[model samples]
Target: MAGVYDFTAQSLAGEDVPLTRFEGQVLLIVNTASACGFTPQYKGLEQLHRDFAARGFAVLGFPCNQFGGQEPGDARQIAEFCETKYDVTFPMFAKVDVNGSQMHPLFNYLKNEKSGLLGSSIKWNFTKFLVDRSGRVVGRYAPTATPDGMRKDIEALL
Candidate 1:
């Protein structure tokens, strides 16, 4: 019965953030990278946050360098890049492995609760996991899926 609420992750600022703080809110959790082809999706994610934040919706970004070393930067650098490049206002977490033995606990739960196209391991960066207000993992979106394309599901959860 463990859920997203049962996990905690370090923020881009290096502060510990308990996922329960976001309980009762629809969450779009994404693994991001600064130098990937999908890096531009940050703008769309920020837009989603702006459009639905007041309605109990949040977009949580976790920087991951496991893919092509696209996000190889310290927490400060990652935070700066997100703000300066995308004007991202949503929360961003410290870089973590998304697929492997060292994967973050939150991501392990996400993949177990909602596997993607072929399996539990995330295929690449930008993979998204949507959690309902109840802290249940509700959907898994591929890296190619755009943030804008998830509005309908987000609206339903909200």
Candidate 2:
């Protein structure tokens, strides 16, 4: 895929969702893991979404189990966990690998567009990629970077 709009991923409910749906919105695409150390970041992500969604901003979460099997749950379980624990209102996709040959196309494009400190491959869960309204990759944040820490950049995009 050349841009964010050229990709599609399965939603948490197993529906194929096209990235084109968010074409004109500033997006924070994150690889999430329910059992990871950064799992609590979901709350912050939800907060960001709630705070900026009215301004054409969104946070898209993609669950991944590749890191220590941190997100070892089915779609329904993950959905319930996110809703009950974090009260997440943003869209979340199904568990997917953010690295390796099996990585989702959207992630593959994101990694290639904005490589991390060392390389394009994701180091762990919770790594975030910021995309502009035009489907352009703007920034890549490490897994350790808290969701709240991205406010400044997200605000700039908005």
Candidate 3:
């Protein structure tokens, strides 16, 4: 079966990053938006990244504009907003569709590995998927689920 490491994504900087680069690390993959209410979660996600990076964990952010058109910025704009507003230091990817026919392949794999409350289709932005060190999807979190609330799960995997 395919795992997270089988895919590649474009970073905000336009580099094509192979997910294999993060193979041995626990990862928190989140669909993000700059103008959404859950935007503040970036801070908590960054905290998670800082607190656990030395322990081989990372928070990977993917900007998605599919939900209410909340993240309509270009790559440079998104990068600037995340850095200036939230001081986000975690790795972030370019904008991609999380639902419908145009959905990114990485997201397709993630949703198939762990379906959400509404089934395989994501309901909104900030949806998070937790992957273990072995590249298996271990947990799926809703947009409303706070990053702080997920600490125990993350710690257990770490």
Model 2 over residues 30-112: C-alpha lDDT tens digits? 99988988999999999999999999999999999999999999999999999999999999999899888798888889988
Model 1 scores worst on lDDT over the 10 consecutive residues at 115-124
Q: Model 1 segments beyond 4 Å from truth?
A: none
Model 2 C-alpha RMSD vs. true structure (Å) is 0.9
Local distance difference test, per candidate?
A: 0.93, 0.93, 0.96
Q: Which 10 successive residues of model 3 have the least lDDT summed?
A: 116-125
* TM-score sort, best first: 3, 1, 2
Candidate 2 lowest-lDDT run of ten: 99-108
Error of 3 at 129 (Å): 0.2
Global CA lDDT computed for model 1: 0.93
Candidate 2 stretches greater than 4 Å from native: none
Kindly report which residue stretches of model 3 are placed more than 4 angstroms away from their true locations once superposed: none
**lDDT value for model 2:** 0.93
Query: Which candidate, 2 or 3, has the higher lDDT?
Result: 3
Instruction: Give per-model CA RMSD.
Output: 0.6, 0.9, 0.5
